[model samples]
Target: MGDTGLKRHGRDRRPGGNDVARLAGVSQKTVSRVFNNEPNVTTDTRERVLAAAQQLGYRPNGAARALLTGRTYRLGVVALGTSHFGPSSLLVALERAARSINYALSIANSFEDDPSGLAEAVDNLLAQGVDAIILSEPVDDGEEPLVVDVPVLTLGAAPVVHAPTVLSVRAAEGGDAAAAATRHLLDLGHRTVHHIAGPQRWWAARERLENWRHTLVAAGADVPEAAEGDWTAARGYEIGKVLARDPGVTAIFAANDEMAIGAIHALHEAGRPVPGEVSVVGFDDIPVAAHVWPPLTTVSSDNAELASVGLNYLVDYLNQPDSPPAPPPKHVHNLVIRDSTAHPPATEKGDTRA
Candidate 1:
């Protein structure tokens, strides 16, 4: 029996070669070849080494192996701590993908206000020996950290750039979906669609606002003052009340589903008929979107796929550090047209037909 003190936290930290040699009655060097996947190890030797590893819990340290080979099989992710829809979803997806590829992920939460914080976080990840880093948030105007010792990749929340970055479903695409929602309202002949946008600091908010403006401009409709909501139903309700009182504001495009739900409640309390007096369209087809009284007509963002793509990209970089950065993946968004949107009221009276 090996000494318990040899392991830390009760984990078997016994050297694989020593355990393999003991079980096979061979030299430790022969065992090393088998464990390293090196050539020249006989099948019988390999089986003995494998058996010894299983008995001793002598798993190879991937990080140590990389250090020996000058490659680390670890990736770092920079995500925001805020509970916004896109960032949070991306983080969860990344965790799943990283595990699937036999790579570990080191995540760092960043703040939007201080863009420099990203570089600082990158430094921290580097210190932790991460092989590559993915920026899930936007890059601020600072000295670009593109050519770090390790490769860097980017997802949404950052502007599109032709570089080593890989983008997976960006806010701009989300904006396009928002535009589709606005156009759905326009097709119904609503004069204009009012918008309750999220906080400006988020890339999703900026992109959605831009799409809303672009859609209105194309239609030659007056874009009403957009109230800012913080991805919360409460803020949505507060902003919805203001839009509800306006006779011209017949339709609304909320940046997220939470806000959309709040907007629905606000409109209901103000006695405005949905799809009759005022139509509402929202982004992000969250679970609750389908449950609302008149289900929300919203765009579905595939965060799971997005996260998986990013994680795969980083893992590949770890395998082939010299592999020229992969091009950003094209993200597809589909609009789910539910009952939340319809013809805006011709006159600000009441028409409650489903």
Candidate 2:
């Protein structure tokens, strides 16, 4: 066995490439080529490398691989630190998609309240040498966009950063989802559909708000004032209480399922049976959407598909800069119709189509 005696640390340290090479009776460069799939190593050599790795419980060093290949093969994600369903779901999807392509994800959490946290998060990811940065659950602080050096992809919001390589998931999808939800209620004979919206600072929240309003205007229905919440069941309950007091409010649309469930509790407490007196609709058909008292009729996002498509575009931009970008995936803002929504009760005027 030939050994170059290339050691990065002490003998007692966790096994690294050097140890794998020594134990497998192969050169360090051969191990690198095998791990990198350079296509020159023999099948016997590859099998020995794997056997040695399994025996030594060794894992490939990302830093070492980056040094050898000149690419970190890491995807960086900048996301809000909240557990809000929409943002959290997309984050999980991004992790899955990145792993599917043999790439790793590094994440930096930014607080929604701290507007400057965006810059700091980007800086942290940049120091990590990620091939691309994904801005997930972006917020609108009314500040100018940050200038970034690497490729940027936005999962929910449109691109908020100025970068050499730019990619975006369906920016119109949120608004389109909102339109679908609103139209569904109006079509069911509701004179007017009230809204319980998330904070306007979030791009996702704003998208739902603006689109809901637009939908109302287009349907020629009376547009009621949108009530804002913190995307929690508690906040939804509070807003729902206010809407329940109004007899004219026959239908309600909450931005996310948490808020929607909260609103349902409020209406029930106020003696208004769901879809009996007040039809309700929610967004982000979460796991518990069906289990709730009355199943929630809400807009469902294909989070996994959205993440995979965005990652493909980012990888494409990195691999083939000269080629035109691939066409973005077409997603339908499909609404899940459940028992929570129905035709409004017949008043003296009766059920009228919008």
User: Which candidate's TM-score is highest?
Assistant: 2
The TM-score obtained by model 2 is 0.81
RMSD of each: 6.8, 5.5
Compared with the true structure, what per-residue lDDT tens digits does model 2 show for residues 1-354?
A: 343344456554577887888889999988876665454689999989878877777778778778866889898899899988889988999899887655799999878899788888889999998888899887765668877898888766553578886777674544489888999999888878899999988888888898899999988999988999999999999999998898988999999999999999999999999989999999999999999989999999989888888887787666666778676655556799999999888874644532
Query: What's each prediction's clash count?
Result: 0, 0
Model 1 clash tally, residue pairs: 0
lDDT of 1 by residue, 203-307 (tens): 668878988899999999998888888889999999988877876677888998899889999888999878767888888788778998898888898878777
Q: Which ten residues in a row have the lowest lDDT in candidate 1?
A: 160-169
How does residue 72 of candidate 2 score in lDDT? 93
Q: Quote model 1's TM-score.
A: 0.74
Which residues of candidate 2, in runs, are more than 4 Å off?
1-61, 171-175, 350-354
Error of 1 at 189 (Å): 2.5
Error of 1 at 38 (Å): 17
Find the candidate with the highest lDDT and give its number. 2
